[model samples]
Target: MEIRHNELIQMYPIGYVHNIFKEAIFDEKMYSSVSHIVLKEEFQDGLKDITDFSKIYVLFYFDRSEGYNLIQKRRYDGKIAGVFASRSPRRPNSIGLTLVELLEVKGNMLTVRGLDAIDGTPVLDIKPFIENDMAGDDLRSA
Candidate 1:
């Protein structure tokens, strides 16, 4: 079956990223990039009571990523795979996700760690990762 599409869905940035990652590539090493999520003044009220959580799920946009190839070389295996199978930044839609530690929340700025998104990237949304069934990965032994 052919899947038709619509453009009714849209997203706006709730904030902007602040980090040392000037370019999309990481420092000499592959995973040394670090960034912080700084929410806009208007969204400050939405972050109330979020400090109780330790980890936050960050949703961002890869604005710098212009276009993507369906199949690209995997950084690990050096093998070409579908974009869906790998974590390459290039995508039909430039949405990005990262689970980072909520180090500290001061006003509208949130200091986080373990995120790889570029600086000035648009932050779509932020969700706290609470310890609950929905946040579990439990499964029966295979």
Candidate 2:
């Protein structure tokens, strides 16, 4: 299939992140803090058996991130790198992904830790973190 560069894709948020931090904070403290992923009432049934996994991947949208820099200095090392090489919120598509520890699941709310996303961040999806899953292996190796 030929992919169109100008094609647009639409997605509805399954939930939103809730935390103490109101703004983006690029620091260790932000990732270490606890956060909540509150799913919509209609999506509540999807949370069933989610607690079986200790860790999960939180895919969210950076709604507040306005623009992107194809090439920029790394936040931590200060070395230059491409946008795709670093975890900068500024990207062609302002999408953020973080692996957070699943602490608890109560009703439609999920208590998690190590989530760097700020409060009210729209959560795109959630997936279990399977360490042994080879699905993440390099495509060249396939």
Candidate 3:
């Protein structure tokens, strides 16, 4: 899991998210927001069979975050915590992940609900959401 210091890493977006959300929000509206994932024409074939899942994980970039702090106050509670402990967009890699409800798929586009990403966000990757990965019968309280 370790790479050489001189190694180079690169990634190209296969698609972009289209939505009405213009800013960061963590409200009830977010749960109802409908967004579209439009994949490049070349990647259209990748959408095949994706509709079988009810949910999928969206991996995207926090392209708008300016900089980051290792420690910060929680937005909802004003409590101090490490950035890693919080969901703030600012981060070491600026990558964001959200598990969203899959609604429908059309050609190279997918309609999904509950995607928190804003319009034009670059989608790094997508994965099927498997409930077995949650690890437990007893969930830990956040």
**Worst 10-residue stretch by lDDT in candidate 1?**
133-142
Candidate 2 lDDT, tens digit per residue, 8-64? 899999999999989876667877789999999999999889987899999999998
Select the stronger candidate by TM-score from 1 and 3.
Answer: 3
- In TM-score terms, candidate 2 sits at 0.91
Q: Report the error of model 2 at residue 85, Å.
A: 0.3
Backbone clashes under 3 angstroms, per model: 0, 0, 0
Report the lDDT tens digits of candidate 3 across residue range 15-59.
999998877655668678899999999999988899878999999
Off by over 4 Å in 1: 1-4, 28-34, 135-142
Most lDDT-accurate candidate: 2
Q: Where is model 3 more than 4 Å wrong at Cα?
A: 1-3, 25-28, 134-142
Residue 26 lDDT, candidate 3, scale 0-100: 57
lDDT of each: 0.82, 0.90, 0.87
Model 2 poorest ten-residue lDDT run: 133-142
When summed lDDT is taken over every stretch of 10 residues in candidate 3, the lowest stretch is 133-142
